[model samples]
Target: MNAYLTLGSVALFLALVAAVAVALWYRRRNDRRTHSLHQLLELADCLEGDLKTCRAGLQQAHAVMSLNPDLPAASEQEARHAIEAGLRSLLQQRIWIRDQAPRASQDQLDRAVSNMIETRSRLGPLLKALDQAQHALDDAMREHIIQRGPEA
Candidate 1:
C-alpha cells in the first residue's frame, strides 16, 4: 500500500511539471506575438504620418498650380495617382496585419516590417522633392504676379 502511494505521488509530480511546461510555452508564444504586433502597429503609424505629410504637400502644390493656368499639371496628376495607390496599399496591409498576424510566423512579420520601412524611407526623398517643386512653383507664381502688377 505504501508503494502504491509513492507511485501515485510520482505521477502527480510529473503531471504538475507537464502542466507548468505547457503554461510556459503558451506564455512565451503570446509574448512573441505581442511584440510583433507592437512593432507592426508602430510601423503603420509612421507610414500613415508620412503619407499624410505627402498628401498635404500634394494638396499645397495643387493649390499653387490652380492659381496659374500655364503651370503644367501632368506631373502633379501622376503624383496624385501614386499617393492614392500608396494609401490603398497601406490600408490593405493594415487589414492583413489585423486578420493574419496572429497566425503569421515571426519571419513573416519581420519581412512585413522591413518592407514597410523601405517604403517609408523611399517616401522621404519623394516628399522632399515635392516640397521643393511646390516652393519653386510658388516662387514662379509670385514673380509672374509681381511682373504683371497687382491690377493687371
Candidate 2:
C-alpha cells in the first residue's frame, strides 16, 4: 500500500511539473506576441509621420507653385526630398505589415503592399510637377536677371 501511495505521489508531482512547464511556455509566447504588437504600432507611427512629412512637402510645393509660376531649382529639390522620404517610409511600413502583422492573410498582405505601391506611384506626377515648376522658375529668374542687368 505504501509503495502504491509513493508511486501515485510521484505521478502527481510529475503531472504538476508538466502543467507548470506548459503554462510557462504559453506565457512566454504571449509575451513575445505582445512585444511584436508593440513593434508594429511603432512602425505604424513612423509611417504616419512619414506621410505627414510628405503631405507638408507637397503643400509647400503647391504653395510655391501657386505663388510663383517660376519656382527655383532649390524649391523643387525640397519637394523631391520629401517624396523620397515618403516613399521610404511607405516601404518600411509595408515591410512591417508583411513581416509582423499578426496572422495576417497572404491576400491581405498582398493588398496592403499594393496599396503602398500605389501611393508611391502617385509621387511620380508630383515629382514631375516639381521639376516643371522649377524649370519655369529658373527661366523666369534668368529672364528677370537679364532685364535687371545684375542690379536687382
Candidate 3:
C-alpha cells in the first residue's frame, strides 16, 4: 500500500509538470502569433493609407479626363500601372501571411514579416510617381476649372 501511494503521487506530480510546461509553451506561441498579427496589421494600414492617396489621385485624374478626355500623360498612366501592381503584390502577401499565421512557427512568422518588408520597398518609386501624377492631375483639374466657368 505504501509503494502504491508513492507511485500514484509521482504520477500526479509528473502530470502537473507536463501541464505546466504545455501551458507555458502555449503562452509563448500565442504571444508570437499576436506579434505577427500586429505586424501584418501595421503593414496593411500603411498600404491602405497609400491606397487612399492613390484613389484620390485617380479620382482627380478622372475629373480632369471628364473635362479634356485626353489629358492623361504617358507618365501618369505608367505611374498608375506601377501603383496598381504594387497594391496587388501587397494584397497577395497579406493573404499569405494571414493564411500561414494559424499554423506557422515563430521563425516562419518572422520570415513572413521580413519578406513583406522587402516587398514594401517596391512602393517607393510607385509612390513617387503617384505623387507626381497627383500633382499633374490636380493641375489639369484646376486648369479645366479655370478655363470653364464656375457653373461647371
Top-TM-score candidate index: 1
Predicted structure with the largest lDDT when compared to the true one: 1
- Ranked by TM-score, the better of candidates 1 and 2 is 1
Candidate 2 lDDT over residue span 51-83, tens digit each: 665566566656555654444324556756766
Ranking by lDDT: 1, 3, 2
Candidates 1 and 3 compared: the better one by TM-score is 1
Which parts of model 3 are misplaced by more than 4 Å?
Answer: 1-11, 54-74, 121-152
Runs of candidate 1 exceeding 4 Å displacement = 1-32
> What C-alpha lDDT do the candidate models reach, one value each?
0.88, 0.64, 0.75
Off by over 4 Å in 2: 61-71, 74-100, 104-152
Clash totals, every prediction: 0, 2, 0
TM-score rank order = 1, 3, 2
lDDT of 1 by residue, 1-152 (tens): 99999999999999999999999999998897788789888999899888888988888888888877888765777877888888899999999999998899988988898898899889889888978887898899989999989998
Task: Give per-model TM-scores.
Answer: 0.75, 0.47, 0.56
Clashing pairs in 2: 70-137, 71-137
